[model samples]
Target: MSVVDVSGATTSRVAPFLQGLAREPIVWLIVLIFAVGALTSEYYLTALNLENLMRNVAVIGLLSLGMTVVLLTGRIDLSVAALMIFAVVVGVIVMTEIGPMLGGRWLVRGNTYAGPIIPVILVALATGTMVGAVNGIGIAYFKVPSFIMTLVSLTALRGFNYVLTNGHPYYLKAPLYGWIGDSKVAGIPVSFLIFLLVLLGLIAFVNGTVRGGRFYAIGGNEKAALYAGIKAQRYVVLAYVISGFCAAVAGIVFTARLKSVDAPLAAGYELTAIAIAVIGGTALAGGVGSPWRTLLGSVAFAAGLNLLAIWGIGNWYQNLAIGIVLIASVGLSRTSRKKTHS
Candidate 1:
């Protein structure tokens, strides 16, 4: 074969590989980070640390899932972390104040309510959904901007967290909570297991259902979707409701893991959650992204944090690192969009 023919063949072979990498930039980034982390520290790649990392990041993973859903609808939710704190606190307060009235006993010889754990979960989820509904109503019905509405919710929910807890923390000793938060199955953390189950459900919802498709359609072009008879406004509200429910789920996981509820718990988690979603290749402009991508993003983010801690990095530097990653991801997303359009 001539030299020109060989060059063409080589290009044909490499082009597909390059395109694959482009399609999953987050996966490559994850591999790179993992390689660096493993090389940098002997402890970074250990099983114990990896397990703890998964467990600890589960709350953020849940939040990121919710953020992904909202972002898919071409909107932002800034209240997830605050809502998380508020929801768990509300759950704790209810179980404490009302458990006795309903003949619920303290199960673990401490503050843990042996009363139906189901009610506590329900109450927390209800609180989150209520707040999310308010946000959705304001944005979808009153034509309020999503950012502003969620921002208001963020403030209110944070205040409610403090008020409900009276600026204190409650330590829970519930058996089921401990099992969900800390127990392991075949050496894997239960919290991480919960996160994985949620991820699977979300994947099916977004990829397998008509309603899920509507979310993407609405996000892609609200006016166009409306014209297509998609009921864009109602879907927007549904997106916020899902976001709220996810936050509440995260709160439940949080309380279980720590066996405690506090006003300040998960403070600033919203920023990290958004960062994770974007890093997973979810476009901030909407109409693009997936739960699978967000899953990769969450793993990458948690790995980064684990590496930073292994290196004895300070908290301030960690925040700086997250900021840098977020900006880079956003830039990459924009570039990819431009390339696609081109």
Candidate 2:
């Protein structure tokens, strides 16, 4: 065959494969959510309930986005929860600085501007980036396995958490901060809106961006990518950074919901994120899934939790449910399911 003909055939073959791979998960999952939600509960079909549910998943959803990247690299980061706790401490401290506490020990409603929100947001993002870099550096440069490196950070981060807050619960003193957690715009919760936007942007990036394409390449075959001169270390660092940022964002959502902070916050969140990632159809072996699917897994799992909570299920049972999901999710690991991995 002529060179031109060969090139055209290759392009045609590759284009359709990418397009089909991208389209199926999103289309099927959206339809499935509505279909199932509509059947199970009256709350599921309502606009308000779904909005709250989405808001509920937003923080974890955000974290799972980063987990998706980490898992994509065929590596895992176990310290995201610690960083999240750290970010909440920073965010609460920033909130106090923005407005004085009304009762010395308590914050009365209808009070001060919760700080610009941007500063806290930046702090969260920055903290996440730094934490991720630490994980990436340990794994990529020091030759540590990602699991061990992140586990070490997990211990250190938990320590930093207590030090940051001085072992006290921190509460925001500003009323404006309330907007981030509970306020609605145009009849929809802003927190949920932000989560949706972030989700959509991530979906597009995974499907279209050059850097994102490299993520899939690295996840699919890191050795091949290295041989092809792809900057593997750079992408590894970027993945951890993204995961860290996700943890920070998740803390924002979480603290906003409670309007309080604990040094031990998100102590088990990293596992939940990983579980969501796995249940979302992302394999533990890496390179076979996307964010939206991870998100769908999150929604299905989260909604089930909420339903359980509403049914008056005890916290003990709730723990058991989560454990089941985690165990089942790990079944999707390449070690167990060879066909799924392929």
Top candidate, metric TM-score = 1
Q: Indicate the TM-score of model 2.
A: 0.81
lDDT of 2 at 113: 28
What C-alpha lDDT do the candidate models reach, one value each? 0.86, 0.77
- lDDT, candidate 1, residue 108? 45
lDDT of 2 by residue, 67-162 (tens): 998998889988888888787676556555554554342224433224556666677677777878888987888889998999999998899778
Query: Candidate 2, residue 211: CA error in Å?
Result: 1.7
Best of the candidates, lDDT: 1
Which sections of candidate 1 miss by over 4 Å?
A: 1-23, 103-116
lDDT, candidate 1, at 121: 84
> In model 2, what lDDT does residue 4 have?
61
Model 2 has an lDDT value of 0.77
Question: Which pairs clash (backbone N, Cα, C closer than 3 Å) in model 2?
Answer: none
List the candidate 2 regions with Cα displacement exceeding 4 Å.
1-48, 91-116, 333-337, 340-342
